[model samples]
Target: MQSNHKKRICIVTRSLSEGGADRVASLQSILLNNLGYQVFIVTILNSVSYPYKGELFNLGAIKEKNDTILGRFNRLLLLRKFLKSKKIDIVVDHRVRKKPFSEYIISALVYPKKTIYVVHNHAIDLYFPPFKWLTKLVYKKSKAIVSVSGKIQNLIFKKYGFRHLETIYNPVDLDYIDKQKIESVTIESPYVFWYGRFEDEQKNLSLLVDSYNDSKLKSQGVKLVLMGNGKDKDKILSKVGELGLTDTIVVLPFSSNPFPYIFNSKFTVLSSRFEGFPMTVLESLACGIPVVSVRYDNYEDGVLKHKHNGVLVENHNSGALAKGLNLLVGDEKLYLSCCENARKSIESFSMEAIALQWKNLIEK
Candidate 1:
C-alpha cells in the first residue's frame, strides 16, 4: 500500500549514467515511484545512460547552452525553483560533494530540511568536506547522512563524528536482473566477466590483467571479458596488448543491461583497490553467477561470504586473486555450489528489503 500522504521526492545526482552510486540513485527513483511518491531526478550532468523512471531536470543541458558564470547561478536558482514548484518533501542527494563552498550554497540556500546526503565511497572525503566543521555545516540542516555500507558509516562517524548517520546497502533490482539475464548474448566462449568503468586507479584493471594472465583459465580455453568505457580504456587495452592476450581477452562497450553478460559468464571478478559496496558484485550474485574479488576491507559480509557465494582473496595480491579465480574454474563442484548459493545470499539487498528501509526513513 502507498503511504497515507503521497510525498514528493527529488533524487539529486551527478548523472544517471555510469558509476555504482548513480545507479543506486536511479534505482531509488524507481522504488519511490512504485511506492506512490512523485519522483523527480535532478542530474548535474547531461549524461543519461542508465534507465530510470521519473521526471528528469537535466541542469547540465541549460549550463551547456550558456556556459557562463551567470548560467551556473541560474541553474542553481532553477534547481531551487524546481524543488519548490514540485513541493518536494524529501531530497535524497547522491552526488560527491567535494566543493565545500558550492555545497555550502546548496545546503544553506537550495536544499530542503529533510535532505539526506549519501556517502557512496569508503573515501568519505569525496562525499563529506575535508574540514569537519564545514562538513558538519554542509549537512547540519539535513535529516541524515546515508553511507552505502556499515564500514563506510563507521569510518565517517569515527572521522567526523556525524550523529545523524545511517547505513543502507545498495539495492539490486533482482526482478529486472532476472529478466535481463534470460536474454541471449552472441558470445559462445565460457568467459569470466568484469564490467564497470575502466579506471585503473580505483578499479585496478592492471591487477585484473596481471592476475588473469597468471591464471590457468586462459590455458583451459576460458576467455577474459572486460566490458565498459572509462578514462583508462587505452591504457587497459595497451596492457592487454602488451600481454599478447588480445585474442583471449575481449573488450566490449558498456551495456545499459550487463545482466545478460553476467548471466552467461563462468563467474565475475572484482580487482578494485578499494570500493564502497560495488553493485557489479551484488548484481552478479543476483544473476546467480558467483564472484571472485580481491578482499577489500570495507566489503559487507553478506555481499561476499568467502566460500559460500563468492571467493574473497587476499587484498591487493594478484597471486592470491589468480588462485581464487583458478579455484572456482578448476573445481567444478565448488563453482556449482557457489553459483547455487549466490542468488539467495544477497536476499537482504533485494529491492523490497532496501526499499522498506527507505520507506521507514522517509515516513519517520
Candidate 2:
C-alpha cells in the first residue's frame, strides 16, 4: 500500500516560461503528482498563465523590481523562509544563475538536507568569476546532482571533481504523442522543417539557412520551414529575405503545442550548436518523425545514429546538414526506415518509464 502522507516535493525554478527546463519541471511535477506527491512550484517571476492539469501551488510572486542585487538577496531570503515553513521533503533546485558568483552564495545559504541540483547545460565556459567557486560549493553541498546529458555530467564532474553525478535524459510524454494521430494535411510542397527558435548563435539557424540555400536540394522542391519566435526572429527573417529564400522559407511564431505541425511535416531538423538533451528531438522522435541534427553533444549520438534512426551531420557545417536532409528526402525506403527507428528509440523515454525512474530516485 502507498503511504497516506503525500511526499512534499518542491520544485524551485526561475519561472514557468516556455523553455526546456520549465517544460521538464512541469512534466516532473505532473508525474510526481500522479504518484501521489504534493508538488509545490516556487518561481521568482509570474508570467505563467497556462492551465496546468496537475495540482501546483505557487509561492508568493516576486515583482520584476526585485531583479536587482538587493532584490535577488531578498528573493533568496524569502525562499529560505518558505522552505523552513513548508518543511519540504525534497527540494529540487533548477535555477541557472545569470551571475556565477550568486550560484555559490545561493548554495551556501539554502542548506536543505535533501536538495538536488539539476545541471541543464554544458557551456559553463561563459560562467563569470566567483561563479566557478560558487558552482563547486553548490556541487559539494547538493545531496545529488542530476545532469540532463552524460556530456554535461562528465563536463561538470571533471571541472568540480564530483564523481557521483547522475545523467537523466529529458523525458517525453509518448502517450500524449501517440494519441495525436498524424493529421491529413497535404504536403503542398516537399520541404525540410526546422521547428525551434531563430536564435542564430545558439541554434545555428544562420548556418542552416546558408547551407540549405547552397544545396542542390534547394533546386528540388525542398524548402526550409522555420518555426518558433525569439529575440533574433526579425534578423533571421531579414537574412532569409536577403538570400532570396523568402519564397522557399516559412517562418512561424512559437506555438504552445508544436506536435500538430511535427506530425504533418516531412521530418524534423535540429541545427543547435550545443544541446543538453534537446526536448524537441525527443518530442519529434516520439511522434515517429525522422530528424537531422548537428552532432555537438553525446545525447545527440543517442538520438540520431548517423542514418540509422536519424541523420547526424558534422557540427557547424551547413553543407553536411543539407546533404543529409537531401539523402533522407530522396530515398523513400530510408526515410520510412529512419522514422520507424526513431519511434522505437523513444520507447524508453515514455512518461510511464520516466515517471518510474523519478519515483525510484525520490523513494531511494
Maximum-lDDT candidate: 1
**What digit string (tens of lDDT, one per residue) describes model 1 on residues 1-364?**
4666688889999988778988999999988888788889999988888878889999978877986878888898999999999999999999998877777888888999899999888877888766688777667668999989888989988887779888888999988888778888867769999999988888999998999999998999999998898999999999999999998999999888888999999999999878898999999999899999887757663379888888989876679889998999998999999999999988888888888899988887
lDDT of candidate 2 over 255-283, digit per residue (tens): 65677778777788887877777788888
Clashes of each: 0, 3
How many clashing residue pairs are found in candidate 1?
0
List runs of model 1 lying over 4 Å from the truth.
300-302
lDDT of every predicted structure (CA atoms) = 0.88, 0.73
Please give the distance, in angstroms, between residue 131's alpha carbon in candidate 1 and its true position after superposition: 2.4
Candidate 1, poorest ten consecutive residues by summed lDDT: 294-303
Tell me each candidate's TM-score: 0.97, 0.88
- Specify the poorest-scoring 10-residue window by lDDT in model 2: 49-58
